[model samples]
Target: MSTASAHAPAASVAPPPPGPRTEPLLGNMRALRRAPLDYFLAQVREHGDVVRFWLGPKPVTLVAHPDGVRHVLQDNVRNYNKQTRGFAVVRELLGQGLLTSEGDFWLRQRRLAQPAFHRQRLASFASTMVEAAEELATRLDARCAPGAAFDVAEEFNHLTLSVTSRTLFGSDIGASVSRDIGEALARVQAFANARLTQLLPLPRALPLPSHLRMRRDLDMLDRVVRELIERRRADTGTHHDLLAMLMEARDEDTQERMSDTQLRDEVMTLMVAGHETTASALSWTMVLLSRHPDVRRRLETELAQVLQGRSPTVEDLPKLALTRRIIDESMRLFPPAWISSRAALQDDVIGGYHIPAGSFVLVSPWVTHRHPRLWENPEGFDPDRFLPELERERSRFTYFPFGGGPRQCIGNQFSLMEMVLVLATLVSRLRLDLAPGHPFVPAPAITLRPRPGVWMTASRPRAATPASGTGQ
Candidate 1:
């Protein structure tokens, strides 16, 4: 044992290679500022799979291929951490919760939270998802007008916000808090990605415009969470909702449970993450389906045949094949959580390439999911690509809408169930058409959002007129 201890690997490891470099101190910041996604994509095309760039003094390595990404996200995950500058912004709002925390803290929180979203629990939650979708359909039914454009982004935001709030808390949070949180999150994400924010010498504790708004959002969200927890604690009713489950959970080691502050962070993280990504997914789904009438018609037919004006139940989900296919195709085209990053703690060889210690390794789902080598006709929006046989033919990393590996999204199943129900519920009642002269520009932010918002006109299914036809 003593000899083995002495023979163990050296205490201090060697520093990694100072990856491919360019021009003055900060390389290509000016170009990256003009178009972030395009600039990043350009770097991948020029510098091969692993290219090193700088955000001011910091070195960022972009990994475009699946093999390289798998090394960072899965193979050597222990050597990497979520210590990115952008992740710091999220830590501010969410505290040391699962999304930002490392090691034991993250593991403990994940374990306790995991069971609350288990597949069996999700069956109950599916009802809430369908209920929210039904509300959206009802609203659209009341507002159907010919040739009038509606921002589908805003509508979907409302839908997901409602679903998240009702599920997390046993009651509704209304639209006001939901809107505030959305606006605040937008500011925080912009600040997180901005080069100017990175250049600022001040510490993160000091509030910038974005930081100030984020704090306000955190406070607002905290107040809501606190009140909900207090009310649940005081109530004698037995509720099996997520918040109640969290309240009852106790850590086995210390028998310690979540404190109010901890609860606030977890709830806020779920609300922001849950609402924003789902809304973006729904908006993109609408934009993609609007452009492809045959896909839309097929979706409508499937919903009509399977659901037939009835609200979608968990059992109905498997039968809603086309609806699921449509959403799967939409996600393939525009995954909300596009880019994810990890900071390496030590130099390592990943796929014959040397990755240096302290380098920010980017595993971009946006690039890998659509890589020409992995996907056939990668840019096309084809739902058939996700059909069982075709899916089996596709490469594993070729479709990562909710990501892969252990750090894969906990609410992935919940999100999918919510999306299918929402789409089926909405399409069952209404037909949406893209407004004329509107361009759907993909603006990649915290999620890949539609630049000007997804503008469309919705009419009752029977009153629906195709883009070319007059209302019947």
Candidate 2:
């Protein structure tokens, strides 16, 4: 032995990161199933940044601090990939799409899909969004009387799915086809969410009732994709939709176009994520506004000044400051994609803890957005904090609802523009208020949508003057 260690005890490795007490083969699964968002927040508050969790025999290390999140998501992102069980569940629904695929394949697909969401594409999409909102407002007027209770969440979901159908497939997609896609996706999402919280989840190969139902829905989604492909192949005219972009894009290296299988996978991914997330985000924004009439009033005033008795355009987005801030604040409080995870490719250190190779690393916007050390009055709804002057001073990774870095959501700008136009058009023509005594607890599934949905009363607002959107 060396002189320094001749009489000393052999060096010992550090103990594992702290976590809630657990039982053999069943650690923390019950807690996670009962209320995952609350459970995650509690874990971070009690155990510090690097909290270890066990679901069954596997250990999951949660990196809750902003620096660690940035490290895994941005700085050394290649060292981690979406190979965790969480993403595996998403992959089961979305196939080998950009959200689940990794390495060279993901890079190639991302490049192929980039131009579909460019500025020009978004301008056309914006027109589709505003037109859809105006049509929805007209429908609501025909059916919803004063004080009539309606599920605004469901309405927003239907509207977003319609817009997505028109923007993704084509403007000619019929209402019946949109309804079929919506019904199938709803069942598939429920099945995926159920799989996420199961402790001893049975194999899908087994003939379980839920598994059989999910397979039917998956098959339906496949048929829809096939139909879209055949239709696009037959048509020779130029189009402004995602399916056309993917079909037309050629690889720089090989000059080869995407195959039918690749198109199917990307379409499935976009159909699920592009609409559901936007709808959830918009519903949450409406709920926040319902609780804060003053914020709603200010938003109306801004819309009046910017729009001036007309629907908002892509060019008017810059002038809608308060409208954008309200959306930002709502997302901070209730992000649609609340939690996401990745698998470590090798050993690494995060938040001063040893994260071993093969460790499952988790990050949650729900927790970090309310981190006391990073946010002031983090639970309170305050839109002013998102003003450019204040937002510039905050940490980059501190409030990542759409994630960050290379793998950040590819359709973020498209989603934001759609949301702004939709809000401007609807809030000026219709008013939605939460039904009295309705609870607002979020159902943390594949998306963080409200549980039992956001029930509200809808009515058209009568403007006192042509220039004012604030009158009811």
Candidate 3:
């Protein structure tokens, strides 16, 4: 729907919402560079829900209110497009993938890719999710030793990458291949993210060391993805996964076949977005669980009562209430996509503030999810806040970790299921304690990664865990 029709203007137009005073030329860029997350948090806290700030010469309005978030994400979504500097960085790797595509083209691609995430498909993949988690748990058993530390963040990344490769591309990616793909994706995204935050980013055409290395890494990823696409194209009804759907799906009206480029873009989009964001969520959940022993105990009790120490299935997801809640609450605290924005296609009003055409509106979950007006003990980890009754009492936009509306992350359920099963499997077998003296600061890159890695000591749980190891 058009923004003009969706939101009738009030009698008088309000000027851009109040914000920090700008400097001569740098604007709020310096402050943002200094502490990105804190700058966003402070903007919403100090300047009300509709906080305006300048990044370089450009003006940015952060819509921290749920009502405003709804306006931008769902109510008048058409008026906002993914024409932001951030998405441009994403296009460097994703091309015109669904995550970065806009308008009718995005609509067409969404229609084609939608079936891969159908309820039946996801349900069928539950065993795949649990089996992958079970493998990770078995591996962790060997790694666990009293007082020994390893990066659980890395472990989750490998697991999610494995799951994504298998489910999305119908390829059983070996651990070593998963590691290689994960590292290559990291390089490309890390470079893109660094360039995004630069006050004056160097042109990609330049053969700087970082740029050259990223080019190599991106080419490596492209070759791998293209091979998978080729393999699927030659398949004879052997696979019915996402890649096959994208390959075989025909546009309803025009009946246009998906191009090689479009297929590749969508495949990479699912791989990177699915793998990275889910890993971030699981890592944060692990940290939160470790910190909150009471909550962890409650979750353990729930899993014990619900699954009876067996592998979790899709049927068990509902009964694993606290397990799902922990994932929900953890994402609220450390949203992987910490920064999300949409360009104003035309003049619009959100939260009673004028958003002139061409300006950008940022609906950061990082800010909105932690808004004190919207959440109690905004910064504290509390899973019960997501209890069905409590969730029903709140506006949906208030807690959008996977985002919302038509363009919500397509892999949301896929990510959630992966997190729950992984959490259940690992928690049932092992205990992860934060390594002494390691900070929990989040490093905001493509995703809000656990900075410097979540170093943790893993040991066999002496309590709650079943003694049979496999938990028969």
Cα lDDT for residue 294, candidate 3 = 87
Stretches of candidate 2 exceeding 4 Å from the true structure: 1-15, 462-472
Model 1: per-residue Cα lDDT over 1-472, one tens digit each: 0100233333244223234455576565656556777776666666566677777677777777766766666766788899987677667667887678889888888888888888898889888888888888887777686777788898988888888888887767767876776676666666554523445545657767755765676676677778877888899998878898787888878888888877877887788788888999998888888788888777776766676567889999888887888888888888898887788898666534556678787777777767777778878988888879888886566677776767788888889989988988888788888888777777766677888787889887653232321110
Please, what is the TM-score per model?
0.89, 0.94, 0.95
Candidate 3 residue-wise lDDT, 1-472, digit = tens: 1223445464147566789878888888888888878888887778788878888889888888888888888988988999988898899889999899988899999998888788888887788888889998888788777777788999899888888887876667776877789999988888988988887888899999999999998898899889888877786766766777678789999999899899889888888998899999899998998999888777776777677768888998877777888888999999999879889888887766788888888988898888888899999998888877898999878889888999898888888888888898888777888999778689887799998899888777655653232211
TM-score of 2: 0.94
- Backbone clash pairs for candidate 3 read none
lDDT of 2: 0.84
After superposition, candidate 3 runs with Cα above 4 Å error:
1-12, 463-472
The candidates, ranked best first by lDDT, are 2, 3, 1
Q: Who is ahead in TM-score, 1 or 2?
A: 2
- Residues 228-265 of candidate 2 have per-residue lDDT tens digits of 89888999989868888889998889898888988988
- The TM-score measured for candidate 1 stands at 0.89
lDDT of 2 at 366: 92
